[model samples]
Target: MNICWWITILLLLHSCTPGDGMDHGIVGGHVSVPHSRPYMVYIRDSIQPNLNCDGFLVREDFVMTAAHCKNLRNPKVYLGVSDTTFLPLGIEVDSFPHPDFNNEPGNDIMLLKLKTPATLNKTVTIIDLPNLWNDKISKNCLVMGWGSTKYEDYSPSKVLRESNVTLKDLTNCIEPDVICNEDPFGPSQGDSGGPLICGDIAQGIVSFRKTQSKGNVTGYTRISQNLLWINVVMKQHKP
Candidate 1:
């Protein structure tokens, strides 16, 4: 099989700047600690530990990731860790990509059911879904994960990193199911499936970024649109 990660490619290349409203910051900045964003996770293909992707906890027994992930051999979830050497907490699990997720750049979302529910504590928590969000969230939110800092760097970031972003018009997105942002920085390699946080709510799932032909526009799976489907899947699969 081909060796590749799950993040998709962008067909429309464009530049994005956070002017009056945007998510602007360093291209990639290190976060305080891996656990600061308790829900963030590393999706490892145990068979090939070197190849992994990003994910986040949504429920005690469920994780959300990108459905476009490829070669997820012996998938395992490692929760809340800056350095993998520490080995915080994890669970063996099975992944279920959205039934309608046809590897399209837009519908690139997935959910995994942990064999054992995660031990939620100081360093592990579930991110609130869009439908459950409160007023604490703002228009500008954060996206954090252990992805690369630049286009040339393929290795995952040793520590978690994040950037603040604001929402842009959906008309700017190439796919109708996606939420495009007017941000100066965007998710890099290995950052797929990461959360787009608005206060306490995770409103979107990292989908893809363009290959630098234009501005820094990032795309994500609009979580609200899939609520019904998510509920259906959870009802039938939650253990």
Candidate 2:
């Protein structure tokens, strides 16, 4: 589908979801990745349990997530995540929301500048972005997130969960403007901004999944498509 179509779809999706609530904490995974690396994000609200999404560390104090995950008009972010634990090595976000994001087709992407830098270790590794045109990720990729298992009106769980899915070929999974034409397999609510990892390299940000049975496609904002924006945001916030 074309860009305009995607944008139109995005606006509709945004309108369907009610965004008038306070922050709430998530139910997270019982076990962390073997020495879990940096790729977990927590979305916060003022008066509710925070939701969990996934993100990656690009710089010491910066993270990237999908724009639609949290609307800019009402936005908050938390980084340095593992099983819902916000480490002392993490940061509370100062600002987020992507510049070019229209939130349609989930082009919605954002970068978070930490109030302080994270303390890193071997487990906290950064994932490098793929080229915008890399097109290397095929039908066999892995997705990890701290989201829900089922879709319906529900709150994020107490422990995080994850699942793997194959990237559907565009021709086979053809939807329109959105990421997957087929049904999304893994990840659910609270996973809107997580990574669509192909091997160890970061390629896309989990954005949207069609509300259907066994949807193969999970929408993601192409990270390579937003490298410039990431750089600009990070530079502006340089200490």
Candidate 3:
């Protein structure tokens, strides 16, 4: 059997044990410098206040995140947040999960259209998406979010935190559309929909992790693979 089919089977078997909803944190990461990542976005499901996810600004009126983060109600979107304790009122947005998502592992990307255009400034900016599919990804990458610093902690962190993770070989990745990493101190709970930044480009979007696996391998939806869809969605939804 080919690797892609094998990966699909493996992911299907473990689908019930996804780590996306757990109140976990970024293990072994450190607090980030205030407003260092201007593209970072904090998303909160208004209907379910405790349900939250991380996302990044990709345009003045659009934010990119994971499809699984979609909720029934429009989420509360906060930008330029370094500390959770003090946050500006969230911007209203409309959730747009990819039509192909279907609550599956693949096609796990989404875009949020802000009701009002964000004011671009020092603390709030947009991250560039990958222009092309470059299989040669940087070994060193960064993932950041507002989550606990240790696995034992259940509470999310008030301040944003970041961890340096090394990208794993794509040959071992579950599928061609994903970038995999097995960092011991990587994204967990509340970290879904965050960006996998490599060489300052938003190369991937945090999708899911194998909760039952020993390596804690996390899969990110490759941004380059979905550029056409992203562009189409953005253009179609533009005001």
Candidate 4:
């Protein structure tokens, strides 16, 4: 598997500039940890650790993310965590990459099962999947991730930035060679496989950058179509 180095550079050189109308420096629009928590994963021998990304728990022990984030060479997960300081508190764990994960560019979502169930406390929590989020999410939705707020030729700032984006029609998304690209560009390099959430519903995962555009769209594997797959995965570890 050939790894792209730009992915590494973009993640490492994250720009930390706070701008107007941003999530107050949240790299992916997440503010100081939500009642419904989101988390990040760090890879070894790649870039910095404890960096942010969007994730929610399915079971107490299972945290799902994109397949590309599972570079075990330096894999680490921060549950309900925000700052780099919280990285140490993150319990290093095991990961399960999707069997058919397309590492090339787009279809790269993955699931991560922590070695031990996260110790649920007041601080750590999970977001439930909304029933209608997938069916109704067509043109308007919100995407959050730890990607670069602006294409400033560097890595995303440590803060989790977020923005509301419109979904592009699939007809346009599946052009001659294009797979996806809707709005708000996409999540920055390290923001892969994060959630494209709308309210309580998870619409899709942050896929990849559209060539040299702003960010990648949520080239999400639609939850509605993947319910059977999700159910099978969840059944493996009923909690």
lDDT winner among the candidates? 3
Model 3: how far residue 200 lies from native, Å: 0.4
Better of 1 and 4 by lDDT: 1
Ranking by lDDT: 3, 1, 2, 4
Model 4 TM: 0.69
For all candidates in order, the CA lDDT equals 0.69, 0.56, 0.76, 0.51
Candidate 3 residue lDDT tens string, 120-195: 9999999988887764577889998875454433456677888899886865775678777677777766678899
Clash count, predicted structure 4: 22
Q: Quote model 2's TM-score.
A: 0.72
Give the lDDT of residue 219 in candidate 1. 80
Question: What is candidate 2's local distance difference test score?
Answer: 0.56
Model 3's number of clashes is 0
Residue 75, candidate 1: Cα error in Å is 1.0
In terms of lDDT, model 3 sits at 0.76
User: What is the TM-score of candidate 3?
Assistant: 0.86
Best by TM-score: 3
List the candidates' TM-scores in order: 0.82, 0.72, 0.86, 0.69
What digit string (tens of lDDT, one per residue) describes model 4 on residues 1-239?
34663343233112243222233332344443443235333322224443334455656777766666655444556665544333444555566666665555433555666766777666566655545423565566665555555554434545455666666674455322122544545466455556666555666666555444454443554545455556677788665
What are the clashing pairs of model 1? 6-69, 14-215, 15-215, 16-216, 23-165
Please give the range of 10 consecutive residues that has the lowest summed lDDT in model 4: 12-21
Q: 51 in model 4: Cα distance from truth in Å?
A: 8.2
